[model samples]
Target: MADGEEVTLDGRPLHLLRVADLKAALESRGLAKSGQKSALVKRLRGALMLENLQKHSTPHATFQPNSQIGEEMSQNSFIKQYLEKQQELLQQRLEREAREAAELEGAFGAKSGDFGNLSHLEGIWVKFRRIWVI
Candidate 1:
């Protein structure tokens, strides 16, 4: 089929599709792609028909309060809340780490330190080594 053309499950457009195009469409819909052109066409048609039926079908199941489903919904809500709390804790930890890093940088006089000077780096390394070694 041509690009930008509306794909129809109708017999004409489906029949016009090349084997490769048919296989591609089948593969896209997670349908079995290993088949002859005619078989592929039939499979695609069935899938499209089923999909159309599902879209048109009305809901058979209705939500009932104070049921097992309600308990499941509450459990899902609890999980969501727990995940949000974990995310908040993670954010706080990241902020703490950033603050500590900034304090370390300040102690090293990083903003004003002469990074181009080898002697300055050597002095900082010596201080770092002394603190760690002790």
Candidate 2:
């Protein structure tokens, strides 16, 4: 965001792209303990995420309408992109579950009505995700 400030490409912000650049940056500053260094990296990553999130707005589905007070913006390219990315993520999750279920078929041989405890039926899914989410 500022001169000499680092930006993240992956989950980590402090990853070294070029060894020379990393060496230069480190040599430019004093050192800390390895644990402290990792914590600093995490904090920097969190700050960058918040900064990036502020730039891109997403419309959230709400129980009580807030459009009256207008804190949430109307759906835009950002919201559309978020929905598309979410759909892709969900599709990948479904495919993973299908694969896992198929693998379990030989062992469990379960039918539609097989599971008694809803937890067993739900398998890998969390509680709120299974509740009226359909």
Per-candidate RMSD vs. true structure?
A: 15.7, 15.7
Which residue pairs in candidate 2 have backbone atoms (N, alpha carbon, C) closer than 3 angstroms, thus clashing?
none
Alpha carbon deviation, residue 85, candidate 2 (Å)? 0.4
lDDT (CA) per prediction: 0.66, 0.51
Best by lDDT: 1
Question: Against the hidden reference, what TM-scores do the models get?
Answer: 0.38, 0.30
Best by TM-score: 1
Counting clashing residue pairs in each candidate, in order, gives: 0, 0
Specify the poorest-scoring 10-residue window by lDDT in model 1. 112-121
Q: Tell how far residue 1 is off in model 2, in angstroms.
A: 54
Expressed as tens digits, the lDDT of each residue in 1-134 for candidate 2 is: 55477676453357643444333444444433243455555544555556577788575657566544322322355655665566557657766766666667657887634434433535534442443132
| Residue range 1-134, candidate 1, lDDT tens digits | 33475346544577788888888889989989987888988888778767876988887588655567535644686765765565556556656655665686789867534334544544655564443331
Model 2 lDDT, full chain set: 0.51
